[model samples]
Target: MNNPVISVQNVDAHYGERQVLFDVNLDVMPGEIVVIMGGSGSGKSTLLKHLLGLQVPTSGSILVHGKSLHDVSKKELKQLRKKMGVAFQGGALLSSLTVAENVSLPLEYNTDLDQNTIDIMVRLKLELMNLGGFGHLMPAELSGGMLKRAGLARAVIMDPNVLFFDEPSAGLDPVTSVELDELILKLRDAMNITMVIVTHELDSAFKIADRIMVLLDGKVVQVGTVEEIKRSDDERIQNLINRRPRSNQLHGDAYLQRLVNGEGEK
Candidate 1:
């Protein structure tokens, strides 16, 4: 197997005094689609932030293309980040810009290409994303599915080697969600891009992932192929897959202490 394109080792993350990720570790190989999945507050988004160098891990390290994000100089980090692209959950387009302008922003900021050349390139990407003729429309005019595709088009404008997608199927109709899934698979196949997708959608994960890493309460419950995950007998994994709520029996003293002190109790 090829070396992992992205690696996370013993990562621990915290927000203020609250710990969100605990000794989390994973690797993403070149051209592989690895899905990080869990329900709300599972630390999926935190892990994504770490991977993108948006936030440093409280402890541990994240390596992108064999370079430690924490150890790299700012210029080096910026260069390294050029190899990565992120499609945020909300599409994250500039409401003020037209669709074509939004998609071309990365090139405008990062490159000195002439207007004609940039326009040509942007059109090609938009066409690939099925938004070729809609470039004149503003973000407010696009449907949910179109917005997602537009965000995706912008994410790939730099031809990044790694793509980080957050909730790709979120906030869309079932048919549109399926279309987005197909588009994601197609993007992987056509571009050979390594993907780390953060999603709580089980069906979407199963459909698009080469492997799935299940996170529960800031820890990895399991990392396996789709079939292996489906066959696992872990109670937590089963509960998540079956959409059953975890039953927690509260210890009165601990609950009372936490409530009074504003701290967590295990």
Candidate 2:
């Protein structure tokens, strides 16, 4: 690859002494959408935190544009961070700030642009995310989906080269989740920005990902395009893809038969 925009090289993360990610390796090429999928406690979010530089890895390294996050000084790290945008889980918008103000926060801190210029930029981004004229509304005033759109507008305010999203479809209805997936695709197509999305929604993952990386037990179980994954013979991948209940509810007898026969699950 020609210098992937984001690179995770043998990354291992821990919470206190308990390890969360184990030797995780991945990359996001420029303008590509890479989805990380896993069940709860699989460390998908932890890996995202490492990518966002919120937590230092216990071992290995994470690099943005080939510069290791651990090797950068505080000032350099801040500068590097300014080149990226993050849409945290649940939108994470400031309830006190109006949507416009929330979107303008990054601009306010990272640039010396005048108020008028910032206002224009904020409006432009809001419009891009289909939230036009709603910028003056408080986060509490908007719907869940709108809040996510506003949060996305804020994330891209600086036109960062890399964008990170956590659980983009959480708590939304199916229709709303599909809409968000479309918006993700639109942003990538229009801006040519590299995107890394953390999600467990299978439908959303197959719809939006150029490639998907399935994480399990703090390690990558499989990584490939949607078609490849769909045709995979790995038992764990099949179980996830076919929506088969392992420790959960069983779907039907046929599914159980397939599981026993190893048709999809190798």
Candidate 3:
């Protein structure tokens, strides 16, 4: 593949003393959906924070467009971040703002566009998210699934080159989750945007990911296409994919140490 839009190399992250990501290396090719998945305490959230520049890795580095985020000037970092979008889990909408206003906030703050133009642009995005005519509704008025779509609309409102989604399928009914997955696929197809998704829904991961990275206890165990992962012989990979319980012996004192370090055992 061409040089990745996002490159993570030998990244080790820590919460105080407890390392959460151990020498994790991955790449996100443009226009591909790469899902980072694992159970709780797997460190997927930490990886996402690393990507978003919210947390610094204890070692190694993350590079976007060949520029390392480690120690970059704040001005440069802000500009780099402008090219990305994030749809956080739980909608993350402001309780005080209407959907149109929430989506318009980015353009209003980031651009020189007039109110009329911003309004038009926000409406266009809401329409693209299949949320047409619902722009005036408050987040509280929408269903769980509609809320997700609204969040997506806001994320892509700026036409970012890279989009990151956190647990897009979480807490929704199966049908709603499936609908969100389809919307994810459609976004990639229509916009050709690079997508990094963090989710544990096996069916959603299988359906939408071009590649999947499975992390376990702060370490990356496997990274492959859906078929490759499904056929993986790694016992942990099998346990995860098959929805089998982790062996208690496997979750021993090492796990406890990791938990004690900072990431408490779940």
Index of the highest-TM-score prediction: 1
lDDT measured at residue 195 in model 3 versus the true structure, 0 to 100: 95
Off by over 4 Å in 2: 247-266
Per-residue lDDT tens digits for candidate 1, residues 1-266, read 68889999999999899999999989899999999999898999989999999999999999999999999999999999889999999899999999999999999999999999999999999999999899999999999999999999999999999999999999989999999999999999999999999998899999999999999999999999999899999999998999998877679997888799987564
lDDT of 3 by residue, 16-58 (tens): 8777889999989988899999999899998999999998899
Q: Which stretches of candidate 3 lie over 4 Å from their true place?
A: 248-266
TM-score against native, each model: 0.94, 0.91, 0.93
Sort by TM-score, top down from the best: 1, 3, 2
Clashing pairs in 3: none
Lowest summed lDDT over 10 consecutive residues: which window, candidate 2?
Answer: 242-251
Clashing pairs in 1: none
**Top candidate by lDDT:** 1
Model 2: per-residue lDDT, tens digit, 1-266?
48798889998888877878888989888888999998888888888888888899998999998888889999999989988999977889999999999999999988999999999999999999999999989999999999999999999999998999999999999999999999999998899889999999999999999999999879999889999989988988888877775465557997888788888531
Model 1, position 23, has a per-residue lDDT of 98
